[model samples]
Target: MLVYVLAIDIGASSGRHILGTVENGHLALEEIYRFPNGAAMQNGMLCWDREALEGHILAGMKKCKELGKIPASVAVDTWGVDTVLVDHQGTPIFPMAAYRDRRTEQVTDKIDQRRLYALTGIAHQPFNTVYQLMATPADVLERTHRCLFAPDYFHYFLSGVMANEYTIASTSALLCAGKNAWSKEVLCMAGIPEHLFPEKCNMPGHILGDLKKEIADKVGFNCQVILPASHDTGSAYMAVPARDENAVYLSSGTWSLLGIETDTPVTDEAARAYGFTNEGAYGGKVRLLRNIMGLWMLQCVRHELDDRYSFAQMAKMAAESCYPHTVDVGSNRFLAPASMTEEVKAALREENKPLPKGEHDLFRCITQSLAVCYAQAIRDLEKLTKKTFTSLNIVGGGSNNAVLNQWTAKATGLPVYAGPAEGTALGNCIAQLIALGEIPDLPTARQMIRKDFDIQEYLP
Candidate 1:
């Protein structure tokens, strides 16, 4: 008997509801619904439209029923760091701040960075929940009763349960370095009340509860609402089909998280200085990775082009174009630049490097520079882990860029296997299968994925 699961994977730009099933001892995915997602500028601040997302979620589930496929369970996985605050009655106190918002810029300076890192082992990012909470007004904090990360909030809405999942909590820079709980010292230093967060953090794959009656009726199904790593990158990493432990995993999408999984968190000074973060992964593993500004550069450039060119067109042009000039694509200046193309030009002019003559040239420059960044990050990972990785596994949407994949393989002198673009959704479904006892364990699931998906390999 085949068991079906629904995996709702949400990224920075879009979200999709993928129906998954284990057929003939292999995984199969069918995307049923997709919707655009983005931050909206409102009241002088950028915020997520929670109600809009919730409506889309319901619509997707209803479509599943229409197709006569009521899943045994459903799970949601979303980008990390951003969260929502609720009052005693479980009502949102304020709009959810987008992680890219500038409100938290000064909050980091107020806290002791070294001490905070010592306690949490999370690299300092202006948009982390710790700094976001610190940026909140005193009155707002006084009224807050609970804090739920983005995915947790959606789960709460579906199941009427309020709890934080460990994987996503680790991204907040509020959780302890090596523990599964929040860091009280870091909370106190950031002026955030411990009581505002969930009383206990639940591990990935913990069943929250059955879907609330109204939600179930609306969707025409009553299935378990499970947590699937909660953090999209965590889910993406889980889908990496590494035959051996000596491979670096890159969850490439709007942001690129390149690193390796470890049994222990790396909290030493060298790791910290290199900006490596130790995030929680499935089965209590730590994702010791560095966050790189990824395809957002291309996405921004596409936007600047007024959506005149498709990504495939850009990639094809990039493959044929020749541009020797390169700029550091991971610079913070590109974070929320008003015009990405302008920003690239500015960086090139500042460096006294020749600027790209055409759009294809610009695209080539971005891809080549990102490959350079990947090469450097791979070397850094080797130093931090004290083990040389023999291969690199690129997963998620950005992996489909054949040009970038070949460039990365050539630049790093390591074999690159890029595929399983739906990694986040697949991993989310895998967690649901594990919870349902359909899959034995993560290692076995990875083996199944290796046989199930189409992975293209590029040799150095």
Candidate 2:
């Protein structure tokens, strides 16, 4: 009998429900529903529409039922760091603030970045939950009964269960270095109450509970809600089909997270100086990665042009153009820029570099700069981990860009294997499969992925 699993993989810009099945030692996926997701200006702050997202989740489940493919279990994975605070009555007390909101900027400035990194082993990001919580108003904090990360909140919505999943919680900058528990010292330092979080954190693959009766009746199906590394990057890393320990994984999407998997967290001064973060991975591993500003630059550029050109068209133009201008793609100035084109031009002018003349040149500049940044990150990873990685596995939506893949290969001087564009959903499904006994372990799941997906290779 074939068993089905559902993966609700939500990113910063979009969300999709994928129904997956494992048969004949291979995995297959069918996207049941997709919806646009973005932070919108509300009450003078950027926030997520929790109700709309909840409605879409129910609609997707109903669609699955209509297709006669009710999954044996369901899991959700989303971008990390953003969270919502629920009151004693299990009601959200404030709007869900997005990670891009500037409310935490002042708070970050007040905290000691180096000390915070030593405590949490997470790099300093202005949008981290630690900063967000510190910026919360006193009245709001007093009423907040529990603070749940994005995926945890959604899982709570489905099962009425309140618990933080380990992987997502690791991104909070509140979890202690090399530990599965929250850091009381860090919380106290930030003046965040200890009671704001769940009493305990659950590891990935833990079955939280069955779907609530109300939701089951509405969707016409009842299944366990399993935790799948609830952080989207964690799930995406789970889908990397690496053969051995000598492989580096890049979960390329809105953010390009490139790093190696390690059994222990890297919390030394060098790691911190390199801006590397130690996030939890499945089965008690640590993802020692650096977050590079990825396609967001190109995304902003496309948006600035009112999306006059499709991504494919831009990629083709970038491949043909001969622009040599490059800027630090990871700079804070590129984050939530008012105008990406103007920002790039400004940076070029300041550096006394040749300015991009047209759309093609601008696209080329972004792509080439990203590849260079990736190469630098790879060098840093090797130096920190003391491991030479022979291959780079590029997974997620950004892996679909052949032009960028080739440039990455050339820049890094390493062979690149790019495929499984739906890596987050695939990894989410695999976690559900593991919980359902359809797969034995992560290594076996990766082997099955290798058999199922066609990975295109680019040589240096």
Candidate 3:
């Protein structure tokens, strides 16, 4: 008998409900639903539309019922660092602020960066939950009851179980790097009450419960609500079918996360100086990674082009162009830029580099810059981990760009394995499969993925 599971993987810009099943010893994924997602300016601050997202979640579950495939378990994984504060009655206290919002800007400087890094092993990012909470108004914090990371909030909405999943909470810079628990020292520094977070941090693959009665009635069925590595990057990394221990995993999307898994967190001065973070991974492991401004520059550039070309067309033009100039793709100027195309031009102008002559030239410049950024990040990872990675696994939607894959392989001087574009969803389902007793363990699931998926290999 075949068992089915669902993974509702939500990213910064979009969300999808993917159905998963093992077919003849191979993992298969099918898209059940998809919806556009973005932060909109509300009351002079960028915020997520909670109503629309909740509605879509229900709609997707209803679609599953319409298709006659009721999953045995379901899970959700989303981007990290952004969460909502709920009152005692479980009502949202304020708008769900986007990580890109500038509210945390002033608060970040007040926090002791070195001490926080030593305690949590999270890099000093302005948008970290610690800074966000510090910037939040006193009245709002006073009324707050529980803080729910995006995925946890959605999980509670579906199951009426309010619990914090480990991986997503780790991204907040409030969780201890070495221990699988919240760091009270960090929380106190942010002026947030310790009780605002869940007392016990739950690991992924544990069952939250069946969907609430109303949801089950609306969707025509009930399924166990499970937790997958609730941070999308954590889930994405779980699906990497590494050939050996010496392979680096890159969860490439709007943001590019490049790093390796470790048994312990790296929190030394060198790691901190390199801007590396020690985030949580499945099975109590640590994901030591650097967050790069990834394909967002490309995405913004494409948007400025008024949707004139598909991603494939842009990649083809980029591969053919002879533009040799490159800029720092990880620079802060590119983050939330008013005009990405103009930002690229301005970055080049400041550096006294030649500017792109056309849209294709712009594409070439952006891709080249990103590849170089990836290469440098890999070098830094090697330095921090003291292990030389032989291969790089590129996953998520960004893996589909063949030109970028080739450039990455060339830039990193390592073999690149790219595919399983729905990596986050795949990892989310893998946890459910294990919980449902359909798959034995993560290693076995990875082996199945390697045999089943069309993983394209590019040589340097």
Q: TM-score of each candidate?
A: 0.99, 0.99, 0.99
Writing each residue's lDDT as its tens digit, candidate 2 over 193-286 gives: 8889757689899999999999899999999999998999999999999977899999999999999888889888999999999999998789
Candidate 2: residue pairs that collide? none
State, as a TM-score between 0 and 1, how close model 2 is to the true structure.
Answer: 0.99
**Clashes (N, CA, C under 3 Å) per candidate:** 0, 0, 0
Look at candidate 1 and give me any clashing residue pairs.
Answer: none
Q: Taking the tens digit of each residue's C-alpha lDDT, what string does model 1 give over 189-239?
A: 878887887576899889998999999989998999999999999999999
For model 2, the stretches where C-alpha displacement exceeds 4 angstroms are: none
What is each predicted model's overall lDDT from 0 to 1?
0.91, 0.92, 0.92
Off by over 4 Å in 3: none
lDDT string, candidate 3, 1-460, tens digits: 7789999998888999999998788898999999999999999988999889999899999888999999998999999999989999999989999999988877787877988999999988888999888888988988999999999999999999899999999999999985778888888778888778767789989899999999999999999999999999999999999999999999999999999999999898899999899999999899999999998988888888897889899999998899999999878888898999999999999999989999889999999998999999999988877889899999999999999999999999999999789999999999999988889999999999898889999999
Error of 3 at 106 (Å): 1.2
